[model samples]
Target: MRVEDSPLIDFIREEHRFSFGTFYFFDNFIISEINEGELFDWNKASEVIRVGQEFYGEEGQINYISNRIHDYAIKPQDWLRFLYERQLFKTFAVVTYRKTAIYNLVIERFFYKGDIFSFDSLLEAVNFIREQNALEPANDFDKLTQLYNDNSL
Candidate 1:
């Protein structure tokens, strides 16, 4: 499951876990910035899923793994099925920190969740996503779902 050399990823950082450079959300996007400690189990992911519901409503079921998250700790195939079956995040973000194998697992399984991006700049990713979503005009469930499917981005 090692990510041999990512063409998709831009850079790598051993410090501060991982981070996003920027992301533009055409709809209500659930961006979770994961730290090394958070990736241990389903609890954190589940919590984020709940918040995403509040943020995006029923359609705000997408899950974006923020920064950290060593892929070795979680089984993404099972995780995706779990989320989809339970009607949690329809989409998700998969990221890597220092390990290639862990990253490989995430990328292979969670690609369909959103527009995948990689970054060594964890703060940059957080800032970018935050700023991008800041102007999203509150969480509009109706428009969000339609836009999610329609945009096909």
Candidate 2:
């Protein structure tokens, strides 16, 4: 079912479909659901990040959630790209019921520096993000500068 048909419609502010996945953008975060058996490489990951930049611009500090409702795999090299570009997200959350996915997330967390959380369902992940977002300042100049490194000035 599309996000609009699902309960997420209320929480999602916008949605975009890419070549390999769909992005559900929320007020303070985004959820990406990759297509089944999709091969996520550095190029694809870059495209996704680019879309996020366009949607939120350089000033937004958004949390990210990967809703792994369908099976997919990322290229090994993409891990380095993800690690290097971790600043694209304030926190990373992965949702999956599959054991293998959970194991992979555990391994990924070892190399990821920022906060990473795993959940068995999308609702749980969104709830956690909402709670975290509530605690964060709406527009703290220092926090924004530190997170986004606003070098435009």
Which candidate tops TM-score? 2
| Alpha-carbon RMSD to native, per candidate | 12.1, 8.5
Stretches > 4 Å off in candidate 1: 1-44, 61-65, 69-72, 86-95, 100-115, 123-153
Clashes of each: 11, 0
14-97: candidate 1 lDDT, tens digit per residue:
112223222222243433343333333455455544544554566534534444434234545555655455755343444445
| Cα misplacement distance, residue 74 of candidate 1 (Å) | 1.2
TM-score of 2: 0.77
Question: What is the model-wide C-alpha lDDT for candidate 1?
Answer: 0.40
TM-score list, all predictions: 0.41, 0.77
Query: Candidate 2's C-alpha lDDT?
Result: 0.71
Q: Which candidate leads the pack in lDDT? A: 2
